[model samples]
Target: MVFKESFWTLSFDGAAAGGKGGTEIVLTRKSGEKLYLSYKLDFHCSNNEAEYEALIWGLIAAEKHSIKKIQIQGDSKLIVKQVSRQFVLKEPVLATYRTTIQRLLDKFQKFEIEHVPHSDNKFSDAFTTLGVRVDIPEEEVTIVIKKRTEPSIILENKDLPKDLREKILE
Candidate 1:
């Protein structure tokens, strides 16, 4: 969805290993001319399962932020297209995930979905180890959990307008 006055901007990530999916979701909203939100989710499961799980958590996350309109970005093309109705899901497994995601999406006042290539998704990549992060209006904080990898959590205050630098500590 295109930004109008205020909209929620967020990314949902799901990674799979040994047929298990891991998920990380980041939610940001435009509040008082900047981006802020109430919550985020990062967890581990199966890749496909996490994909679906991310969408579920995404809906909850945006809802918690009081977001009426949303624009979601993800690396799963199949998930994007299936949810968008551009392509029909034929896989039995994907069909289930699609259904679950659709239920969460139905709760939104306005919603749009798109796919980003995996390489550009640093949030999900960094959350590969199953940790969660959350930011609320007037709150600067990070979710503390176990680490499974070396990726530093790039926690930023959504109220600030800034360019993202990949893997760099500034």
Candidate 2:
């Protein structure tokens, strides 16, 4: 089936356990083609951090695909609200995440993000759960496994002062 115009749907979910985490991103084109990406975080982070990470990566993927319009769905209400400016951000780290997301959002001509029930977001959630639990494989799989050594925000903003960078890394 074809959409009226070029549009895409992006869904993301994140799972973290015992200082490790994983993020799953599903990008679907208007033509019904889907791309799945999963990432293993090598750094320690909270579940919220993982959610932000998933979102950042998902946007990056969509930008790479040259998508101009997108519909974003996630189960994290906090992340969605924070990104939408409905919630006040209290954490510095997440503030950084929000900033990064804002910058990425500017690349798209149109985009909308909404919170969905966990059950409604099961596909991405299930993939994220599996990504967090499974060990990295030696061979290739249908979904290529990627490793994130640090937060994407940190990686993107290298010009920050050393002290602030250290604090954010902590």
Candidate 3:
């Protein structure tokens, strides 16, 4: 399958506050077109988890767009190092995230991840911090929710909170 461009550039960032987190991704094509994605995670996650979610979600967006070669840029030094094989992931949760990211990246023909300073990644950082506040043009922004783990079946409908039960009903 011939692609329109030789490569795409993806910049990602994650932000966390009050035990909640958000992720943002910006994808730019060689032709100067751009796509923005942001996700609000319902589950509790650390800053590192947020970073991994950004990386993984960006890769998934690339795959969906039929992009084969890409450059990934992010502000998370630890995530960048682990993905680049420069550092080992000791935490079980992070290890799982790393594995998932690697699996998705394997689908690409060529991919490079680099750690950029936070200043260099201001666009994504702003979106992450804002969560879903600012709305981009409908064609440009994609919003999603990131659930790190599946919901447990152990909880019966009667045991779920009213709001959660209503969501399940939907």
Candidate 4:
């Protein structure tokens, strides 16, 4: 089944600070209805890793909604370039992230990712920063707040090589 009218605009940002990380996602439907999601990372990760997590979770939400076409915007140039294949991924963990993102992209009928400046991505960035600094109750805010215990890729790939799995799970 395909959703012909289900085109969406997705924007995401992630931040890691003081051994904690968080991600925020904004999903805008073609009708202009918006959904906000904020995730607190339970484990330590780099800023780049957190960025990838935001993108991954956004894609998952789009898929759940059966969105066939999407436009994705992010402030992480490295992540956007790597996912678009304009840049090479050197780190093993990042390679895994790219691979997982590619798999998710394939599920969509059409998708495009573009790099945006931080100033242009302030909404997600600001929420993500707040999400990292304090724990907000879902009932207290309109944004949906959730926690991620581990990387989505790690949970999906059970057959991963032992060494790679260990490194990513670290």
Candidate 5:
């Protein structure tokens, strides 16, 4: 069978705070397009469960998008190794997760999972920092849950004529 030349990149990260947890999935296409999804876990779960949920959801999304080749990355070493079949799963819950992930893996023409350091996975890290509240000095807690198509710093400001700018603004 001829393999496709295109591939998509997938990354996942999970965060837990005050008995609450969430997962983030970021998918990047070869054309520099990206899709980000973040969900807050309603039930109680450890960090590992959240990570697996992220991976599973990400894979499902790839299937929906008809992606045939994928390179998966995650900060969770155990989940990555287990999914890659490089490490044995000891926990029953994680074993179940692995089974689900394996079933999804069959849908792809080619796929690989790698363990990456948290520092190198800054985009996923940023998603985990969502839904967090930080106190600014003595003021109220500021909730930060940013979901943007482009990074705020890199956004381009097009200089349109005054008339056009006024019409667009209106």
Candidate 6:
């Protein structure tokens, strides 16, 4: 069940004016033994909506990069609830975004959305606060990879050149 080569993290953040709240998002995937993908977007929208959009855009980016398995990390509890099927879609505003996310889920071999407290998502918060956006999305995200593993056979599989598998045999 090793997915991701190294660790590719994707982060998206957003903010809203007047009454809306800001949002921050992060998605991480591993590329063999290196990390190549991480994104952060800060913009304005309803708090819930912004959260949804962050997740949406993050998935779009991951798909664009051809990521097969993704573990989505977020700071909003409500967003995680909705995405993980724990809460029902009561608000109509989320319907569209939920649809978009559902489609993305179909593209990955494994997808799991986890909820972390805002404290745990400090980096993502800082990213969104650094001038959040309302209409446009930011593409400035930091992606770092550790030393490449020469014997990363899991990543060598032709079908999985982009495959990132991490495992610890007991």
| lDDT against the true structure, each candidate | 0.58, 0.86, 0.75, 0.85, 0.70, 0.55
Model 1: how far residue 138 lies from native, Å: 30
Q: Which stretches of candidate 1 lie over 4 Å from their true place?
A: 1-5, 31-45, 129-170
Write model 6 residue lDDT over 24-77, tens digit each, in one string.
Answer: 444554533322222222222466776766676567667767877677777778
Question: Which sequence of candidate numbers ranks them by lDDT, best first?
Answer: 2, 4, 3, 5, 1, 6
1-170, model 4: which lDDT tens digit per residue?
98456569999999999877999999998788998888888788889999999999899888887888999999999999999999998878898889899998999999989999998987778899988998655456443777766776784587887787655433
lDDT of 2 by residue, 11-58 (tens): 999989988899999999878899999998878989999999999999
Ranking by TM-score: 2, 4, 3, 5, 1, 6
TM-score of each: 0.62, 0.86, 0.76, 0.85, 0.73, 0.62
Q: What residue runs in model 6 are displaced by over 4 Å at the alpha carbon? A: 1-12, 19-44, 133-170
Count backbone clashes in candidate 4.
Answer: 0
TM-score, structure 5 vs. true: 0.73
lDDT for model 1: 0.58
Provide the global lDDT of candidate 3 against the true structure. 0.75
Tell me the tens digit of each residue's lDDT in model 1 across 26-60: 77655633332212222344455556566655666
RMSD (CA, angstroms), candidate 5: 13.2
Residues 22-71, candidate 5, lDDT per residue (tens digit)? Answer: 66888899889988776555455667877887787678778878899999
| Pairs in steric clash, model 3 | none
**Superposition TM-score, candidate 1 onto the true structure:** 0.62
Mind giving the per-residue lDDT tens digits that candidate 3 earns over 36-123?
8777655577788888877877887888889999999989999999999899878877877787787888999998889999888787
Tell me, by TM-score, which candidate is best. Answer: 2
Model 2 — which ten-residue stretch has the worst lDDT? 136-145
